[model samples]
Target: MTESDGDQPTRQRWILIRRSISGPDEITYYLACAPLDATVTDMVHIAGSRWKIEECFQSAKNECGLDQYEVRRYVGCYRHIILLFMLVQAFLAVMAV
Candidate 1:
């Protein structure tokens, strides 16, 4: 992929993985940036983990009000996110009992 940063164009190598067992419509395409020697297994693993990561963020947003904040500063936003994660961790710990 080529992206322009100001005036210079930077090129990045992206790998496309087509995962499907049935038809063309059922195919899942994954575009990822990885090493030239990276295998299909590595790309698949990375793609699979994306769902879990998104789920965790969604859970945080839903249960902890993680997305409800309106902070103007970077440090404030960072602290708010950290606090939300701490709250989530505590909630999980209590539920595990």
Candidate 2:
């Protein structure tokens, strides 16, 4: 429901609770819950997003050598990544538009 700051990725969390009843005369009920409340479909979405990001990381690190930039200064690094992202955004916009 909330977007992460800047270009940072979003994180998903979920929790689930379930109850079961069994036995004879006196039925006994037990509760089982998962820490994450998300359903199977939601989990699949999270996993797919993670995999896509991982693929991007691989492409950037291995193919583009994104981290190989010679910018050692904080400002330089920030500017470099920002420009790279901007270019990517522009490219996407052009393609979509």
**After superposing candidate 2, which stretches have Cα over 4 Å from the reference?**
1-37, 70-97
Flag clash pairs in model 1: none
Candidate 2, residue 82: how far the Cα is off, in Å:
5.7
Candidate 1 residues lying further than 4 Å off, grouped into runs, are 1-12, 15-29, 74-83, 86-90, 93-97
lDDT of 1 by residue, 1-97 (tens): 5555687655445666565657756666666666546666777778888878788777777767778867789897787766767578569758979
Q: Estimate the TM-score of every prediction.
A: 0.58, 0.37
Q: Judged by lDDT against the true structure, how good is candidate 2?
A: 0.53
In candidate 2, what are the lDDT values of residues 1-97, reduced to their tens digit? 3235477635434433223346345532222222334566665455446657766655555545565667668897686774685466556557768
Q: Model 1 misses residue 92 by how many Å? A: 3.2
Candidate topping TM-score: 1
| Backbone clash tally (model 1) | 0
